[model samples]
Target chain A: MEAIILQILNGLDKGSAYALIALGLTLIFGTLGVVNFAHGALFMIGAFCAVTLQRLLNLSHEVIDDTKKDFLGNPLKVDVPYLADWFGADAAQTIIQWSVPLAILFSIPIMILVGISMERGLIKHFYKRPHADQILVTFGLAIVLQEIIKAFFGANPIPTPAPPAFTGSFDFGALIGMENIIYPYWRMVYFAFAMVVIAGVFAFLQFTTFGMVVRAGMADRETVGMLGINIDRRFTIMFAIAACVAGLAGVMYTPINSPNYHMGMDFLVISFVVVVVGGMGSLPGAVLAGFVLGILEAFASMNEVIDIVPGINQIIIYLVAIIVLLTRPRGLMGRKGVMEE
Target chain B: MLGLATKDFVLLLVVAVLCLFAPVLLNPFPETSDLAQFNAGYPDLMQRFVIFGIFAIGFNILFGLTGYLSFGHAAFLGVGSYSVVWMFKLLNYNIVPGLLLSLVVSGLFALAIGYVSLRRSGIYFSILTLAFAQMSFALAYSVLTPITNGETGLQVYGNDPQYLQGDSAPNIPHLFGMTMRATETVEFGPWLWQFNAGYYFCAVVMLIAFYLAIRIFRSPFGMMLRAVKSNQQRMRYTGLNPRPYTLAAFVISGMYAGLAGGLMASMDPLAGAERMQWTASGEVVLMTILGGTGTLIGPVLGAGLIKYLENILSKINDNILHQWFAFMPDGLEDFLVAIVHPFIGKGWHLTLGLVFMAVVIFLPGGLVEGGQRIGRLFGRKKPAEAEAKAAAKTPAE
Candidate 1:
């Protein structure tokens, strides 16, 4: 029972990431009908936002004491960060605690601009081309984005600490009657934050007239156009929203997995698999499938199962995807006529 | 007509001669000059040009002729490399068994993957192939680490158990009693050029592969493939099964990929999971598409161009650009060098992207069409030439 609960928690955090990425992917697929392979890169850019903000906030004023020297004749110096000087010494040292969450505001505009530019500049031309061309072009875009980031950031993962207040684990052993049942506070925070974002996105889509129009456009773009609506403009906005969502996910993910240029690639494959398993263009299905796969992945990685199959944990997701694909061609919530000729 | 035939034959002969003497032809500066590194007209680059040409040619057969874009072809190439390395480790360093095993294993693997993936079409087909490729990559990295040697890649030590060659085998096996790397260098004036045995061996194989490709291009099977690409539904209505033909094409391409992989392993003696990544698979697609997918000779040109640019552009760092602009004023030189610096050296991808976009926009029929367009612009030629050029310019039905 304890193990199952623990696995569920593990699953939820991972599922949150997958769900967020897949949701964005589905949104792009739904609204624009363009499979944005560069969505992962957008997510990566978001994580980099946190890294950048931390670096920017940590920039310090160096004070060199020419009168002081070490045994090796090195100069002694004291550096004071701008944040520390402004807020206080204690506050300046703990700026990462604030800057990480603040990155959401910093990343949103940049991500939106990137999303808009990408849609208008490159993907706009590829819309009429074959799906293969769209994939190739977007894939090329993804590579370009990743390589540019890599050139700037180098290949190393930069660790982003959560705010000092949310840095520990919550011990659930007392309530559970188990010796140890500890869950990381940051992970719990991540789950709740994901829920809030997911709720916000769902509410924006469900309640607004914009969502209805976009959904209608998704069903039939020609009919929407016939209704004297500019579906393309709405689609571009949705793509930007999707980029923001991915960016937010990336921003929050930095504390869990240190931000790196290649992190997008690692998540992109799994998120793509998640999208496929959830059924292409199905938003709600993407969310459900992400959590399900995450839990299953958690379970597969357990010692007992791993001891039997060695690397079953890594292969299990693909095996499951293949099985799901073979059994349910349209996926769990896949609509009819989507894959139909 | 005799004159036309002679011209065509001479054109091909000239290209062959140019490739054969590329080291001499590409050497712009004398060896006695201070800039020796710039004159890197070595065997490695030459071998790479031919090897990637083979890869792209094989990829073009399936993608260009059949109009089936595979996103997992590199898995076969990686499999070929791994198989060859294993052969060297377990059997002997002899190239024959390794190459043969590479072809067989990769062909069989492709047969399995294609059998399932070909059931779908368009985006689904691409996704299916991509999934399998990722699976292969992941398995090689983690699950099959014993076979693949994980991230460090599979390699062979000198003290490997050679069952076939026994105690008589040399450290590096010979081809018909000829050393693979044995070469004679001749110095003429200020330039030194080497005629490498390995390069010639690869060149012979490449020529054979090219001949085979040309035969396939003109065969009845080739016509059927074109018909399938034109209208699969119509082909089905006519009681013709496109499945078997597509499968055959897939297998043949896989074999070609395996051959390329085997040659790579033979040249470098190592294999890694990175070779099986989707990026590598995508590269062959770029080569085929950029060069001219359906055209017989387009892929070779595309492959050679991409590989050559990768080698040259990667070596042109900021310092090299600065050196070129040294004659200008200090500020102006710095600005000029900085402007050109990003497009080369780590930023070569930006150039590649621009080229890809240009190709997709203007020359959809590829470099072949570009060539014909240039030819037409030069002035009036033979009526047959004009007509042939017109037909080539038209996108495949």
Candidate 2:
């Protein structure tokens, strides 16, 4: 029971990331009718935004301190962060500690601009082109984006810590009357944050007029356009919103997995599988399948499972996708004619 | 001659001659010249040029002729390499049996994968193949470590039992008694040319492959494959089952890829899971597209161009860049070097991506189309009329 609970908790954090990215992918697919291979790059860019903000906040100036001795026994040149001097050292320390969350605010405008520019510059010309062309161009774009990031950040994974308060693991075993079932506090925070974001998106689509039109446009673009609605403009905004969601998910994911240039590509293929399994162009389906696959993946990686079938975890998701695709070609929640051809 | 049309016969003769004398043709620069670095006459690189040429040609058969874009074809290549290595480990270090086993194994693998993946067409087919390949790669990397030797790659060891090997048999891969690494260098004046047995062997195989590809391109079977690509629904309605034709193309192409893989192993005698990665698969696709999808010579050109860039262009470092720009003013030279720095050496991928994007966007027909456009600009021939004549020549219903 304890192991099962622990696995479920472990699954949720990863599932949250999958759901967020899959949600964004499905959004772009649904609205733009595009297979955006660069969606994962957006998630990567978001994570880098957090890294950049952390680096920026911690920018240091050299100070010679006579009290501190260097390795050679001379006066030590201590590098003190400018933040420590500008704000009182305590406030600056707090700000630095909360850099990951602060990156959310920093990444939003930047992500939106990126989304808008991508839509306008490259993808705009590809709308009327073949799906193969779109995929190829976006794939090229993904590579260029990642290579650019690699140029700036180097190839190594950069560790980004969460706030001090959420760094410790919680004694979930005591709460549930099971010993030795500890879960990280930040993971729980990530889960709650994912829920809020998911709820917020769902609410935005359900309660707002703009989202209603966008949803309507998704269902029937031509008819919406016939009703004199500027569906294209609204869809562009929807694209930006999707980018923001992916970005936010990436920003929070830094503490879970260190930000690396290739992290987006690693997730890209898996998220694509999630999108396919969830049924293409289905938002709720994307979310549902994301969690389902995440849990399945977590279980597959268990030692008992590995003992039965070694390396099953590496391939279980793809196996499931193949089976699902072969058996139920439309995916879990896919519409009849969506990418059937 | 050889049952080919006059034009095709000429093309074949030209290609054969090119392959036969590539050492001299590819090495235009003298050994002592400043431009000597541009020469691609080395045995290793020449072997790769032909080997990857074979790979891209096979890929073009499936992708160009049938319009079925496979994203996992490299898995077959990897399978071929592994089979050949296993053959070398168990049997003698002869390439003939190794190559044959690789073709057979990879063909069987392709048959199974194609049977499932071909059930879906278009983007779905691509994704399905990708999934299968990724699964194969993942399995090879982890659970099959005993066979694949995990990250260190599969290699031969001294303890391996070679039942067919005699005490005097050479350790390196060979044809009968002739070693693959055997090379003869001929120097005349300032020019140095090397002829390697392995390169000649690969070049002969490539010529045969290219000839087979040409025969297939003009065959009724090729026409059917093209019909499937152009309109599968119409072909189905006309009482032709496109499935078998597509499956056959997939398998044939898979065998070609396997052959290439076997040749690779025969040259190096090692196999790694990275050969089966999706990126390697994408590299083949890039080669096919960059050269021209449906053209006979395009894939080979694409393969050669990409291999050249990867091997030669990536070798250009900052020091080379500075040296080349030394004639400029100090500030201008520094600026030029800085601008050129990121697109070479370790940054070659960025340049490749940019070039790929440009080709996809502007030259959708690939480098062949660009050539055709230039040809038309020079008033060599009326392209539309020539296309019509070519279409009329083909016995398409």
Name the top lDDT candidate: 2
TM-score: which candidate is best? Answer: 2
Fnat, model 1, is 0.32
How would the docking of model 2 be graded?
medium
Every model's DockQ: 0.46, 0.78
Best by DockQ: 2
Per-residue lDDT of candidate 2, residues A1-341 (tens digit): 88788888888899999999999999999999999989999999999999999999999999998999978999999888999898988999999999999999999999999999989888888889888888888888888898889888989999999999999999999997899789999999998999899999989998999989999999999999999999989989988999999999999999999999989988888898899999998999999999989888888989999999999999999999999999988889998888887
Clashing pairs in 2: none
Per-residue C-alpha lDDT of model 1 across residues A1-341, encoded as one tens digit per residue: 78878878888899899999999999998777787778899999999999999888888888775788868788888677788779998867766577889898899998999989988988888788766677767776777788778777877999999987778888866776885679888888888988898888889888899988988899999999999999999999999999999999999999999998878878887888888889888989888888888889988888888899878887777777777777787767777777532
Please tell me how candidate 1 rates in CAPRI terms: acceptable
Q: What RMSD does each model have against the real structure?
A: 3.3, 2.5
Fnat of candidates, each listed: 0.32, 0.67
Please write out the lDDT profile of model 1 over residues B18-111, one tens digit for every residue.
6788777666577888565566467787778788888888988888878888888999999999999999899877888889999999999999
What is the Cα-based TM-score of model 1?
0.92
Worst 10 residues of 2 chain A by lDDT: A1-10
